[model samples]
Target: MRIGELARRSGVSERSLRYYETQGLLQSERTSGGHRHYAESAVDRVIRIQTLYAAGLNSKKIAKLLPCMRDADGRPNEIATPTLVNELTTERDRIDRMITDLLRSRDVLDEVIDTAADGATTDPASLARRR
Candidate 1:
């Protein structure tokens, strides 16, 4: 299919698709007239790229990791070098920390909301000023 069709099917913008090609995260063939043509599997490839990006992997990292990716399970097909394995492990740990921090923040917000709902929001500072 053409770039437009791939973009529509993958729900990624054409600009992003071009950027992926430029970044070597995606592949396409050029026609005799120099128009880009992609295979049907390009749809799955685009989705995979988007998924990696969504997981906070940059283009360079995604490019490096893409070749090692297996199916859609986020597993490595072959044994990665120690350095690459460490890098990916670090990224996963960072994501975990981010999730933990978000959960903590959400818990705080929930407490505040509950307090307000219980009508315990009378301003202590206002009371002091009145005194």
Candidate 2:
């Protein structure tokens, strides 16, 4: 399909698709007239790329992970390397920490909301005293 069709199907912008190509996360062929053409499988590839980006992986890391992923099932292939595994583990750990921090922040916000709902003092010093 063409870039427009890919972008529409994958819910990603054409510029993003081009950027993915430049980042080595996606592939396309040029026609005799220099128009880019992509295989039907490129749709799946774009979806996978979007998934990785949504998970907070940078383009470079996504590029590394893409080659090892099975397009059909989106599972890792048997080409695991120690370096790749380590990097992925580290990225997972960072995301875990971010989740933990976000949860803690959410808890604090919930407490504040509850306090406000109770008609508690909005003044910081008075609220601290009431607490």
Clashes of each: 0, 0
- Top-lDDT candidate index: 1
After superposing candidate 1, which stretches have Cα over 4 Å from the reference? 71-78, 120-131
Candidate 2 per-residue C-alpha lDDT over 24-117 given as tens digits, one digit per residue, 9 for 90 to 100: 8888999898877899989888988888888899998998888888866666666967899999999999999999999999999999999886
Give per-residue CA lDDT, model 1, range 8-92, as digits (tens): 9999999999999999999999999998999998899899999889989999998888887775556656766788889999999
lDDT of 2: 0.87
What TM-score would each prediction reach against the true structure?
A: 0.83, 0.82
Residues forming the 10-long window of minimal summed lDDT in candidate 1 = 71-80
Candidate 2 clash pair list: none
